[model samples]
Target: MAGLAGTGLSGAGAVGMALPAPPAGPPAQVGGLRVCERGDTTYLLDRSGRVRSLTYARLVPDNRLWVRQSYDRAGRLTGLSVSWSGFAGRLLDVRGSFDARGRLVRESGFRARGVTTPLGSYLRAVPRGLTC
Candidate 1:
């Protein structure tokens, strides 16, 4: 076994996937962000600089899976979301806003069916552990 274990499921309506064993160590940091990897999975730290969100890519169809964290301006985490896209081509749209204190006040999401949506009234909140 590698540093991880995975389940391979197949047959009727079954999806085959790989699940890595968790990493061992304190979280790693890059710039102001903390980084972690479980096999091929990646994670980001919160403003308190703790691992708060994770992302992984599917090995079979080679799709991207995203796990994200939201935070207030004061550096407190407020919310989180997860999304995925496949080889057939898909765009994921997730939107959320935070208060001055960094608390997420509202959030909304929609699937992009070959077209992007207008910015409209949605507000974007930067996650704590990301460079942007």
Candidate 2:
């Protein structure tokens, strides 16, 4: 359990794939990263090929809006938002904004009331300007 709702101060997620390699296809542009699709799921990758974001199908089959991400033209992350789909369509998490120099300005996060482990969750995921 990590933050669900702050400034981009948490989310120290490592750049790695959560699933197997996507099926072959020309890389699609996702914000400042390259995106590839595997069936209904899409993966965002940085210039170095690190994972950045993921968008997979929801109950609506082709509903790619279940997750969203944005970045500056130079590849700095600007926004990221998520929500469940259909009847359960509720916002799950968000992060946002970058300074003129492309630094993360602020993020949206939750308090994480019962989270114990400082791993995986935002508690352990320090943002760019802050020390954990």
Candidate 3:
């Protein structure tokens, strides 16, 4: 039987089996720095080569942003936060949970002060269909 990775869930479900490989040339440039891109998605890598943030333009023309947190040697996320721009600006204070394999199993968010009040506990489930 095909495992989750074989079934196209590898790398946090960012890659699908039928999807073409990322471009083979040098990474894309943003702000005079090289960035990794998959199709139109772009990722910002820190000096240590870890992903620091992501920026993508949605199909509807709205831009999405994600900020990643640092982790300690023990593999726990030392901090977590996220923000999106649309309808003004919305910020989320995020916390992540990981399984034994270090894969993120869940995440919780709270609306930061000065942002619009989020309905329901400010928590939303990560949809399986989402990439990145």
Worst 10 residues of 1 by lDDT: 117-126
**Global lDDT of each model?**
0.53, 0.47, 0.49
Writing each residue's lDDT as its tens digit, candidate 1 over 1-132 gives: 332335343343243555689887766666666775556557566556455454544434657655555444355556656455677665565655555665557758866676453332222343444441
TM-score of each: 0.38, 0.33, 0.29
TM-score: which candidate is best?
Answer: 1
Alpha-carbon runs more than 4 Å astray in model 1: 1-28, 39-41, 45-49, 71-76, 79-83, 98-105, 108-132
Candidate 2 accuracy as TM-score: 0.33
lDDT of 3 by residue, 26-104 (tens): 6565554457656654555544455544444433345454544434444334443455555455555455655555466
Over 4 Å off, model 2: 1-25, 61-65, 68-81, 85-132
Q: Order the candidates by lDDT, highest first — what do you get?
A: 1, 3, 2
How would you encode candidate 2's per-residue C-alpha lDDT over 33-68 as one tens digit per residue?
Answer: 776655655666667665455454455553323555
